[model samples]
Target: MTRRWTDAALTAVAPTTWGTTYLVTAELLPADRPLWSGAIRALPAGLLLLALTRRRPHGVWWGRAALLGALNIGAFFPLLFVAAYRLPGGTAAVLGAAQPLLVAVLTVALLRDRPGRPALLAALAAPAGVALVVLRPGAGLDPLGVAAGLAGTAAMAAGLVLTRRWGRPPGVGTLAATSWQLVAGGLLIVPVAAAVEGAPPAPDGPALLGYAWLGLAGTALAYALWFRGAARLPVTRVSVLGALSPLTAATLGWLVLGQALSPTQLTGFAVAVAAMVFGQLPDRAARGRRADQPARGQRVGRPAPGRQVEQQAHGRHVGQPARRRLVGQPARGRLVGQPVRRRLVGQPARSRRQASAGASAATPSGSAPGGSSAAAASGSVNRCAADGAAA
Candidate 1:
């Protein structure tokens, strides 16, 4: 449990560092080159990680790595930049806030997992809290930007779920897997950046510093930690941590840019924090309910102790052998090899008594004159019937 929270905190660092992207781009990076900027951020980090890991994907992992890269970084980064450029920052953030909810739905559809009630509520509450923190009055809504933002959110959400689903290939570390994705995603973006933005701009010292931070810490380290947690933790839980991005952005604006926060923003901050924290907690009720369930292939209930012998005797419970009579003992109310004798329905009582006396007199010693065993078996059957009646 402690390890789970640790992984969550480590994973959270990715988005928290991401919160600084707006500030970094506005203050440090070259202007009017968002595509080139994304390419720089991804390509160098990926190359650096590849150099360090010295491992490559094999077989199906090659295709899997490309798909994950496209969703997580290649397509997502371009769409995100488009949204940020075309829409108001507030509106873009509010749209991106829908990621947790998207992840929840996709988890059910793709992974067949039902998130707990708390997780579902958190998914709804996270977007509302983010809207409060980042949304502004009369924020302009561009159709293209809205579409891009939603697409980016969906892409990232799908990437997150798929990351959890596929996980790291055998014997490959998180760093290696992250490197594969970054490299694949970076390679994909290079052509688009070159086509759209023409040549890369010469970076000044501050721009170089900014690129290094975004590449090494933001892209490489951040994604490595993110994938590690995704492999170890629930996807919904990890996606909820994305709410921290806007909250962190808002905080940086206040501290670094001298922006002031209103009471409503502060309230929203508290609510977002509360929702993220609540989402992290283990669902004890869900765990308890799962614990109460019977394991697969197990019987639901056991027979009563008193009925076990009878059931076993009839080959009903454990398929034991049928009950056997003891030597010289009778079954039911008759000797083992003898036919049952019955009196006529309307026979007189006196006649019945006389017949019984005659049979007993013939076996005075409780044994027939020539067939002692038959007489003994008959006596035993009669005793057994009387005992059964008493019982």
Candidate 2:
């Protein structure tokens, strides 16, 4: 499939799966076992995917993959769970909405992408929408949970940038990367889960279903889709769409858990979706251009006319310095245009000797006869001497 279609599909799918996170958390999972449940969601499914794909990531990809695993899964998963556990659900959800703003800042600092005025404005709207939909009075807004949620969002943003910057190397499919991350994250969290909630009681039937969905669909499939979407779309816009996840979570809370979505919250969701659509549009000028534009064509990608001329002038300046350096030293190339006067122009023999002595004093290097002899006679021997010194 074309990258555009695939990216759109993946973006649509990823956030939808993510919307299920709250449902799985509040409805199905055992209370006070968020850490263990999160670990299970990551590790087994990751290993299973790895086994199915049977592909190994190579080179810097190994380290990059592991780092991504740590950021997107290992660190993020537990932190998210903690935010949900420690804070009011609405509070955690609102803070999570700040991802697009984080992505824009990171893209500028890390990716060197200039997210121009429109993208910046659009990115701003997404987080505002998130705040509108999720923040509420009396929500457990602790310092740690808020920090964890924001940091988790930042980690996910960084992971997206890293993934996009280092695209999947040849022969490494999406599933392999997803699987390895899951397994890596799972392993990293195992000890923490074991230590904190050793041998936790088994979840009931609905909880098991929720766990399975969170594990198989939310972590594995959602991440696979997220990475795939991120590879093709701008990272900032992808994070903007991520605003939908929390809003969807709230809507599901209303429908499935008898929670309420106010008119203001619904408006926030619409604004965020609008911002995402606006931010993701490609630059028209950047497209429809060839990488290597041919000469004598109106090549859109070619250097500007003024720049081309300036570059040529600069090239001549460089070449002129080299020719001057060769003048008082040695000439490897043919010196075909020397006039008789050039050899002894405007100076008596004694004065030339004094000049040569002065140059030799300034240079203090071995004198050679051939290429640079003319420069010495022209009373500009220092030009060649300077070039020699520079060399």
State which candidate has the highest lDDT. 1
- Model 2 stretches astray by more than 4 angstroms: 1-6, 284-391
Q: Candidate 1 — which residues are off by over 4 angstroms?
A: 302-391
Per-model TM-score versus the true fold = 0.77, 0.71
The residue-by-residue lDDT of candidate 1 on 174-250, one tens digit each, is: 99999999989989999999999999989999999999999998899899988988899898899999888888888
Q: lDDT (CA) for every model shown?
A: 0.80, 0.72
C-alpha root-mean-square deviation, each candidate: 11.7, 12.5
- Candidate 1 lDDT score relative to the true structure: 0.80
RMSD in angstroms, candidate 2?
Answer: 12.5
In terms of lDDT, the poorest run of 10 residues in model 1 is 382-391
